[model samples]
Target: MATNNIKLISPDSKLLQYTQIELKDPTDAYLESCFAAIQQNRYTIESNTLVQIGQTNKKS
Candidate 1:
């Protein structure tokens, strides 16, 4: 069996997510992509949240 590496690209072509799928069977992968697209914005928001948390911890 072969595998395909796919990256969920953002509107600006940034990499929002990544996954490996079986080349011969990608149905589940497609469904996952749909969910990923909906949650893509969360990725950036989460990243910012982490940075803010880190800074707050450092100050405490």
Candidate 2:
């Protein structure tokens, strides 16, 4: 079987709220549940500042 890595990030209360939510057990009991859970998390990336910086700055 092939495996891939993934990452998740969040702040405190949001993290705690996320932790409290329950997931249904997989019928196949696949080990991929870990990856699925991580993929299911909600995230917000701050793209505004990053877009401005990249546009305003140029590399030499």
Candidate 3:
């Protein structure tokens, strides 16, 4: 496995980002679990298609 440091630049701004530290072998079940976790949890809609993590609602 490898680690990658990412940077984002916007007009007048710069930010640092970190990718996941662990990489798993790909599989359908793994994908399903990930999607399921996301779908079942609460999320706050930041926009039409964007959401902030850790902002999930308890009612979900």
Candidate 4:
């Protein structure tokens, strides 16, 4: 498994946070698709996991 650290910043640019995501050798295309899905509200982070809306299984 590989871990990636993503920096979360506030809209005001005053606050910053970091989250670690684990994946199995994730590729750039996979990351980009995840970002797009998140922006579209198709996926969300819950309990340190990425879950697709309308689905019961978590995406790793």
RMSD of each: 9.7, 12.0, 10.4, 9.8
Winner by TM-score between candidate 3 and candidate 2: 3
- Per-residue C-alpha lDDT of model 3 across residues 1-60, encoded as one tens digit per residue: 232323445556643333333445565445444444445554333444434467545885
Off by over 4 Å in 4: 1-26, 55-60
Give me the runs in candidate 3 sitting further than 4 Å from their true place: 1-26, 42-52, 55-60
TM-score of 1: 0.26
TM-score of 4: 0.44
Candidate 3 is scored at a TM of 0.28
Better of 1 and 3 by TM-score: 3
Best-performing candidate as measured by lDDT: 4
Clashes by residue pair, model 2: none
Instruction: Sort the predicted structures by TM-score, highest score first.
Output: 4, 3, 1, 2
Comparison by lDDT, 1 against 3, better one: 1
Runs in model 2 with CA error above 4 Å? 4-30, 42-60
**Count of backbone clashes, every candidate in sequence:** 0, 0, 3, 0
**TM-score for each predicted model, relative to the true structure:** 0.26, 0.22, 0.28, 0.44
Ten residues in a row with the worst lDDT in model 4? 14-23
Candidate 2 lDDT over 7-60, as tens digits, reads: 224443333222222334563234344334434542232442211112245689
Q: What's the lDDT for residue 15 in model 3? A: 38
